[model samples]
Structures are given as C-alpha cells and as structure tokens.
Target: MDDDIPTRMFYAGRRWQVTDMPTRIRDSVWATEPGTGRGFYGWRFQATDETGESFVFDVYPGAEGWHVHHCYA
Candidate 1:
C-alpha cells in the first residue's frame, strides 16, 4: 500500500484538496461471502486539509486504479 501520498477528491459537489500526505489508519481484508471466495483488501486514512480541517478517507484497489471510496470532514 502507498503511504503519505497526496490526493484530491470530489465530494458533496465540491472538490476537496488533501493538503498533506495521507496517513494509513487501518487495513482489512474481507471475504465476499461466508467462506466462499477470495476476499478484498481495503484501507482507511486520515488527512488534514489546508483549512485545518481533519478528514477521514478510504481507498481500495479497483479495475481502474485506487479509488477514493469515501470521506468525512
């Protein structure tokens, strides 16, 4: 997993700039079903923006690339 990477995201109809490098908060692997198939890996992060607001974000690998799953300010 990549750490301390700068990223940008569009949320709530606005673009949020990740002012600082993102820090990994947690990591997890979960199965698609109950002991049925291969699982997926994901990560959570915490970042602070230029406005001094802290935000929580998540990212996961996909067909395209690492996608920003969600964020909370």
Candidate 2:
C-alpha cells in the first residue's frame, strides 16, 4: 500500500492500476469454529481504475503477507 492506497493489483494474470483513493474502506474480523484460537481479519474497498471502471477489492493479512483476496468488476 502507498499512502494508504493500493497503487496496483493483480487479478486473472493481469495487473490493474488504481487511479484514485479507495472509498468506503472497511475492516472486520471473523472467529473460527469452536475455540480454535483462530480468526481472520479483512479489509475491503471500492475504488475506480484508470479506465474509469469501478471495482471492489479486498486485502487480508495472512501468515506470509498481505494478499489480494478478491476483485469484483
């Protein structure tokens, strides 16, 4: 992330450029089944691309690193 904004993202073997600051930034956490001592944290955003198309993108922290979980066009 650059200046709290995603500058680029990869999806479907291609890279998409984030042209504007993300809107509606949200965060959440989910508990795992039955006291497994595990949970998941997520961050979601609605942003526009350089081509003027809108998309929903998500990023989550995992054991390894931050990952792009999903993208909706």
Candidate 3:
C-alpha cells in the first residue's frame, strides 16, 4: 500500500499541483459512524498549474471514485 500522502492531482482536465499542505476535512466533535465524519470525510487543498493559475478544491470519494465536491478560484 502506498501510505504516502497525495501532493498533486489531475483536476479540471489540468495538472493541479498542490502548492500548500493538504488538509484533512473533518466534521464537528460529535456524531457517530464513519469515524464521526472525522478524517473519514475528505480533503481540501490549493493547487496551481504551470501558468500559476490556482484554485481551492474540496474532494471526496464516493461509491464510484473520487469526486470533486466544490472548487474556488
């Protein structure tokens, strides 16, 4: 298993290289199941391309595959 954390990804049909630390998204300190939606949630990170265009992205895995939940310019 590759335990290494992800620092880059192909998003928006482009190379979005992570430029900042990938932060794990977590729910509040309540609830149950799925580890209380803690680290089990997903991730948010910022990335930029070769042209320096950047975006903030939120992604998570569904039954199919990793899906982009939202994005910000």
Candidate 4:
C-alpha cells in the first residue's frame, strides 16, 4: 500500500502474547504485530490526520510475504 495514504488502523483483538502495548494509546496513531496470543505475528495499525479521516488497517502473513488491507468508512 502507499505509505502516503492517510487512514485509520488498529488491532481487532488481543493480538500477540503481549497484553499491553505502548503504541496503543489515544494520540496521533500506532502500529503493532498481531498474533494468536502465541505463535506467529502480523502487523496492524490505525492512521489518521488532522482532517479526522479513519480507516481500519491490518496486515497478515501471506504465502509469499505480508498482506495488508485498509478499510474505510
């Protein structure tokens, strides 16, 4: 995906084994690796700008490499 694109992204559930993340805070935005609370890990984040636009963002492990998706509302 284009890095310049501004959108909202966030973890859906308790991704990874880590319960607390410094990135997960009410501020500008953040990103993290999503996991099954044990094995494997992926990337997720929420992006927004001063405009207030938002998009649900998530990246999962793919056969070739990493697959990312952005949902807008």
Candidate 5:
C-alpha cells in the first residue's frame, strides 16, 4: 500500500483503478488478523475496469499480504 492507501489492483484477469476515495474500515466486534488488539481491518473502495465496469471492494491485510474479502458489483 502506498502510504496505506489503495490506488490500483489487478483482479479477475483485469486491472482495476480505484475510482473513488478509499475508506478504512475497523472491526471492533471481531478480532483482527495477526494482531491482539483492534487495529486496521481493511479498506473499502470503488474501482472500475477499462470497460467501465465498477465494483466496490473490501480488502484486508493478512500474513500472506492483502486479500479481497468481498466485492459488490
């Protein structure tokens, strides 16, 4: 992450560019991965492909790196 912000990503055989400002999401009710206390859970942002298809993604950091937790098309 560049300064803890998401800019672009490649997923589903296509490159996606973040179209809107990213918002950090915190989970106080659930335990965060790789940490004991509540901390940075993930990021929520809208992205678009070259074909102009857009999706909202929820991504989180893990021991293996970043992961796409969910996506809303």
Candidate 6:
C-alpha cells in the first residue's frame, strides 16, 4: 500500500563509504578558550603536501603577525 517505499530504497543502494587519507600537517585550533585570557602564545609548523611540495605556517597572538617556517622538497 506504500508506493514511496520503492523510491527510498533506490537511493539507499548507491551510497558509498569514505576512504580518504589524513593530512600530515595535522592542523588544530590553538586559540584562547572562552573565559580564559592565556593560551598558546605562538605556534608554527612546516607542512609537506602529498606531492612533496612544502609550505610553512606561523601563528601568533595579537600584533605578533605570521611568518613562514620554510621547508625543502
């Protein structure tokens, strides 16, 4: 008595599983938490892509500013 049952089953059969790999740079949130005034003063790291391309990221609080960490290959 339910014509909508067949339509719902058709879409459920085509869903696939996710199999992507994780990044090596391993980014994370390093900001000051709520109700707190002190946290990571500065943080930096060099990241390499899957193709061996390298890049850097530097994070600092307030007026410190960001700078490249530098990397090879």
CA-lDDT, candidates in order: 0.59, 0.62, 0.72, 0.38, 0.86, 0.31
Task: Indicate whether candidate 2 or candidate 3 has the larger TM-score.
Answer: 3
Task: Report RMSD (Å) for each prediction in the order shown.
Answer: 4.4, 4.1, 3.8, 12.2, 3.0, 17.1
Q: Write candidate 1's Cα lDDT for 6-66 as tens digits.
A: 4665545555566555655333345556566565555565655556576777776689776
> Higher-TM-score candidate among 5 and 6?
5
Task: Write one digit per residue (lDDT tens) for candidate 2, span 36-73.
Answer: 64666655666565556777777776898767777777
Q: What would the per-residue lDDT of candidate 3 be over residues 19-73, giving only the tens digit for each residue?
A: 8888777664222365545543667889898889999988776788667778998
Q: Best candidate per TM-score, number?
A: 5
TM-score for each prediction?
0.49, 0.49, 0.71, 0.29, 0.81, 0.25
Candidate 5 has its poorest 10 consecutive residues by lDDT at 28-37
Q: Record all residue pairs in model 2 with backbone atoms less than 3 Å apart, i.e. clashing.
A: none
Candidate with the greatest lDDT versus the true structure: 5
Clash pairs, model 3 backbone: none
- Candidate 1 off by > 4 Å: 1-29
Against the true structure, candidate 4 reaches a TM-score of 0.29
Model 5 vs. true fold: TM: 0.81
lDDT, residue 45, model 6: 40
lDDT of 2: 0.62
* Stretches of candidate 5 exceeding 4 Å from the true structure: 29-40
| Per-residue C-alpha lDDT of model 5 across residues 1-73, encoded as one tens digit per residue | 5787999999889999999999988775245554666655788999999999999999888898888889997
Badly placed stretches (over 4 Å) of model 4 are 1-38, 48-53, 69-72
